[model samples]
Target: ALIAAFEARIRAQPVHVAAEVQLAATAAALPPLSAPVDEEAEAPAEEAIAPRAPQEQVRVRADLLDNLVNHAGEVAIYRARLEQQLGAFRAAMAELDRTNARLRDQLRRLDLETEAQIVARYQREQDSADPTFDPLELDRFSTLQQLSRALNESAADLTGLQGVLDDLARQYDVLLQQQSRVSSDLQDGLMSARMVPFDSVVPRLRRVVRQAGHDTGKQVQLRLDGTHGELDRNVLDRMVAPIEHMLRNSVAHGLETPAERVAAGKSEEGTITIALRHEGSEIVLQVSDDGRGLDRDAIRRRAEQRGLLKPGAVLTDTELDSLIFEAGFSTSEQVSQLAGRGVGMDVVRNEVRQLGGTVEIHSVVGRGVTFTLRLPQTLAVTQAVFVQIGETTYAVPVASVSGIGRISRERFESGTGGYRYAGEEYALHDLGLLVGQGPAKAEGQAQVPLLLVRAGDLRAAVAIDQVVGNREIVVKPVGMQIASVPGIYGATITGDGRVVVILDVAPLVRRHLAQRPAAEAEAQQQRHVPLVMVVDDSLTMRKVTGRVLERHNFEVVTARDGIEALEKLEERVPDLMLLDIEMPRMDGYELATAMRADARFRGVPIVMITSRTGEKHRQRAFEIGVQRYLGKPYQELDLMRNVYDLLGIARARD
Candidate 1:
């Protein structure tokens, strides 16, 4: 009916009446709905179901529940064994009871036999004078001898009972031994189950390094070695942030541009190698790059600027390298997506330590840098040396403890006086005094427990009331309220169920060293504020640098280019010249050569601060007697440190 109505409406439209009439004829010739539909219903249900077929399910990975179920079954098996052991123990106890009853009966028989012998002896003494009593006495004595023979038999029986008890005791020991083995194996298997491959973190690291290179306009070729090494899953997860941060640091601060690499007699591509491997029970990860290495002098100067060290404080190369891990410390002048916020390295150190790890750095002046992170495979357990400080108990990581000993009161010194150990002197830090407990019992003629610990490049002996030996402890995090407490890392429960704080040896040593009295002010005082020549074609560069130097109490001279700088030099030789690489006429290279040729300015220091951070530029600058090559967009601290260091000008303030 609906089709006929539609046909009639189409015909009334009049635009295509002939077509509409033909469609109506076709509709009228088709089979009507009232016709039997049995044939259509006879079609297969399978065909009507749209050819449904089963499809395999896709999953990202296997479910953890499967492994858990297997372990649960194994645990059940161990539980059954434990029940069997309990039954065996009960049987052994029953046998032991039976043996005890037999031994008690044997003892009673021996006591009765002994009493009969005593009675016979008394009768013999009373009948000694009578002949007729002789026969009776003989009978009584014979009875006594029989009783003695029975007592001997009872003694033999008692020995047999003792052997039975001993056998039961051995069986009990074997049961306990078997149970212990099963428990240990289960624990080891569980720990192993928690491990994962080190390369699990590589996919994310690759993305981070690639993005960093693109952002920095540098070509960094990253190669991973021993990626299949396994680590605890939790340790690997926590390590992601630190490793990613280090990778970003290498790309942004370590690697050079393709053009720069070529100029430095290196390949156009910069190479970063991340190698992982097992070192005994520990996992060793090395991140190394072939690039301009760390500048120790720059680091020392920066440390002084941050007030981490006094001006002109002398430190070894290793000590200087370690300053980078200080909180809120960074060398970059500008903040970017990658760095310059001064937060990465400290986080790296703290996180690594939380996993019972250490970070060591090695670098050469112009070759490259390598950061080595050594961590235990798992954080589930660790060996610690427990010590008692005042009334509090503390656990120090065994890895960080160098030695333990006792020092006589006469040999021990307070503060920076240092203590002698094995013919060597190291800084001595009294734990009590360091923690604000005042001087310890120094007047008493008693020996003090000294714990020698290594904190980075410095070794020091910490005085404590007592050394509590070593223990394997399960580390647990401290409450949030005390998370910021200095020198304490975490807490763990002792065997006696007492909670003890774990001491972070590194922070303790750092804290003590920082408290040392500064050496007397530098002997050499500057006669006057040093004069500096700021040479740059960019007016803004000249002004900024000049103003920075002036603020640091430096007399400033300005020049627009190398030609103008030479003119200024002719008038007077400045103590230092901060020259730019590119200029309108007679660029820095040519001007540097001119200055080297001059007799008066030959000894004067020339520092090149420029946007051209290529090795070729630096090599040329060095050849022309540039004392330092500082990259542009430099930190004000870096600039000041370099100026003060090169000019031999001591900081006026202590």
Candidate 2:
């Protein structure tokens, strides 16, 4: 057993030259007791065990210390450049301040000049009326008129100066825009320089996977896909332990033993696939295993044993899957090195949350289990959806924003009720009202800007005045005075010098729910509404279509892109489809073609709504079997008319 264990360890790790030489020497020095071994003609054991350098040693051309030094130098250079730019920006601001002061001085002089001219005119009229007026008084009035004329000339010059100043301000704004772009690029480049491939941690993860497989007496194969995908070095460093724990969980709990897998009609050797892919601005890392999958029954029973579930309370599959992340929660019967401690998963959840990432689990019993970790490329900067509520600007992490759309008040069955989004019912909160800025919507306003936010299992819509746009923002913590605010997560400075609040999603939703208990009941009643799937990447477009559909009494499900649309389709096919011509990943033509190929979706009516109005584009869409082609900025009535025609429903005229 000792010899076998030693051999296994040697096979697992690359042998060093010194160790190989020592092992050979020790083996050669041993006495040969068998006649067959003595008769064998061979070179000395030391020579036979040729000392070859490990593959990793051969592959490493430069020392890691040298690489670190080089990267540090690059970072220092970027810092210097950033500092210089900031100094320039300050100088420009000072110049602008001086120009403003001069403009103010010019305006005051002009005002005084006008008043003096009026007084001189009145004096002249009085002097003309008086026949006995002194020459000195007449001369004084004439001097005052001359002074006013000079002041008028100065005012004209000031007006030209004002034009120049206005031009300068416009130029300054342009400069600022350029500077913003440059700074963003510089920051991105600096971040990219710090990005390391997902492969960086794969070797270590591979070892852990192997060891866990051995300990559990299961044959497991680890395969990595898209290992070249880059992630921030700091984020990757923090991810090492959590990823290892997840892989261990896959091998220990997710994958069954050889016998069990075979009995379940699966291959004798289980496979654990770790795939890394870039999804828009985020990186998606999926750890999946093919084994006897998550046992929902066992998880429920364990939850009951631990008193996590109340008596006679039933939990959905989604809720049951989430229970595994609870602190001190485990389904394993016996404690082991890999799991059953119930400490790892909760730690994983906490770390992910700290990094502004999300971890989701999808399991199909007897098929497999998949754990997906969606993380931003870097935590220092995050893409956020900027919105306006009353006069305040707030930003929400893009990951939390499921969709954006306009919600018309006229669409609600009552004055205020719940709405359905993405085939799920969620309470809608008026952001302006919640923040005490004003009413949710201004009186007599036709539509409200709505943002769909999903945090964990909770989904809700927030009403804002408008969505300024989406951009990458560096978040800073609010001071202690307002840090305790329930829904305020840090704050960030916008390019135009506005300090925008970043919302803490989960808490904000909780606060909204607490304030309006009636919304919960309304949400329960929204399940029976007709669902419409709105697929478009633009936030404005999503809201526009959603609002139009809602106005006609249809609930809407929205997707940012065609890929997400397909995922939503897997969950629930909508009563009607509204697709855009151009989108990321998959466009309308491609989506339509793909859907037409699938028997399940062949009969679904697709209305191609897009800005691409070229005849060729329309012809191509028609060829792809789109039922309708609506041009950009279609009127509400026209859009509804087309939708009703396709869905065979009549729209009531106001």
Candidate 3:
């Protein structure tokens, strides 16, 4: 009956009644319900779930991280300085202890002597039967007794102080060790935070290769290995442009067109590979291309046209390969969007150098070319060798040093123009002179310590006044004014609180090679002369000595004192030296000792002639290896005999 009523209502108002009519019909077709359910049967759900654990990592602003790194590096520098200071303090304590022991021994001797004198006086008074001679008077305070007692008390106090100082030194040492460990950990953590994977720049590198191949109308494939390798974020960011430039160069210059490759029996597609890996403390990156290699003839012609090489200049293959990095040097015939403006490789070299790194080229003319870049694992801190060149200290990156040795000043000036090590000849350079520090004071040492360094294909032996030992240094940037200076890469603070310049070896080697030809020519011309050096403060003495040597058919060099003589010795070594004992700056004895210690001048006989003709002076001169000692107003014949004997030459006809 309800379904019929709903149907009649739907016909009256079809749109509104349709849903009600359908509900009524469905209800009429269903079976009857059994029972109603209870509301209590169902349980309520929990209002909230357990809270999630806090995030373990959070992003930090780069500048904030960089500032933290700087602070940590400062802490490290302070720790190193504190360690040195502690060592110095320990040495002072040891000296103080020795001084105290000596003082106590002297006081004991004084006390004993005073007691013996008092006993002797008492015995003399008693033996003479003097009534005023009292036995108690012997024990009474006298000036000598009082002085001895005071000395004994002071010595005892010094011994107590020494014990306290020793304890304090030990405590300080413990503290310093703890600080060192903490500083090392903090630096490592900060550097690790700054590291980023190599794949961070892989996308951009691929884009560079793709775009370059498209523009050059060549088929090129980019392959990457060791993408998981890591570098400091700052280093990776700076390397992007340089790596991109190399990729473009390989595509434009290294690869051949598809048709050309096919004709040459190579695959139609060319491959360029970028490999990254860690080598010891450095990160090595290599960009290589398997295609038509560098055209040696084309590069040679360009070098000639650019005047970098003389026409028909004879050069080894390595030497010729290095010329491509010269600024504004290119072998491309026509200027194009990709190349021929002559700008890429030099910029690449400069960028790599700025990062405290080195770049090298390995190419086979028909095979291919590979560019290798070796960079510090991190820019924040690096291992460097500190060397004292003059009053100042400088740091050389350990990565650049191949070996260290001591070369006699004689061997350096032997007109060989270089030092040989491991069967290879390396050009020798004076670090003090190269940096405009003038000649370093020899400080009585005979041999100069030198570092054998390699920069790319170039090698040189850099002579320094002393090796200050190797250290891990925090690198700091110099201001814009100093940054433009050649051969200076950056600055570091030593443990002694001195700011040392970190040398860029590549630029130094380049500068040396650039000036080598002229230096060699000059050395050749002066090598034939038997040079005699006269060192005296008196103008008349120098003039008379020079005149005698000149008359004897020998070349003469004169210096006002030992300092001047050392400076002149840089030019050439003399066959024999005439030294005066009383000259200023550096005395004759000091000079002789220094010369005898040095292997270069040890064979050169020295004659000391001074106004002070005492036996003591003569003995000291002979002890210092001076061959002859003469008093003032020496006989001319005597001087000539000694000179001729030392030179191993026969006397000339009178």
Predicted structure with the largest lDDT when compared to the true one: 3
How much does each candidate deviate from the true structure in C-alpha RMSD? 35.8, 23.6, 15.9
Which structure is stronger by TM-score: 2 or 3? 3
Candidate 3 wrong stretches, greater than 4 Å: 1-55, 127-138, 422-424, 439-448, 512-654
Q: What clash pairs does model 2 have?
A: 405-543, 406-543
Residue-level lDDT for 644 in candidate 2: 81
**Per-residue lDDT of model 2, residues 1-654, tens digit only:** 434444555667655645755675676676654535532455566556886666662233324533543444344344445545565666555545544555566566865776666666656677456668633355554555566567657666766766676677667667666765675576656566667788778789989999998898999999988888888876798889999998999988888888888888888999999899988778888999987678888888888889988766887888888888889998888998988888899899777766667788888888889988878776666789988864578888887778887677775324477667778766777676566555454322467777887766667777776788997676565788887777676777654555788876666666665766554444445333457889986766887788878777787889867888888888667778999977768988888898999997888899888988999999988888998998987887788888888887756766
Ranking by TM-score: 3, 2, 1
Assess candidate 1 and give its TM-score to the true structure.
0.52
Q: Give the per-residue lDDT digits (tens) of candidate 3, residues 345-460.
A: 99998888888888889998656899999999998889998888655888999878878988887786563667788987788786765675544434446777788988778888
Candidate 1 lDDT tens digits, 354-398: 676788899886678999988876666567888775447789887
Enumerate residue pairs that collide in model 3.
Answer: 446-598
* Candidate 1 Cα outliers beyond 4 Å, as residue runs: 1-169, 385-395, 402-452, 461-473, 476-478, 481-502, 510-654
lDDT against the true structure, each candidate: 0.75, 0.75, 0.83
Error of 2 at 617 (Å): 63
Q: Assess candidate 3 and give its TM-score to the true structure.
A: 0.70
Question: Where's the lowest-lDDT run of ten residues in candidate 2?
Answer: 57-66
How high is each candidate's TM-score?
0.52, 0.57, 0.70
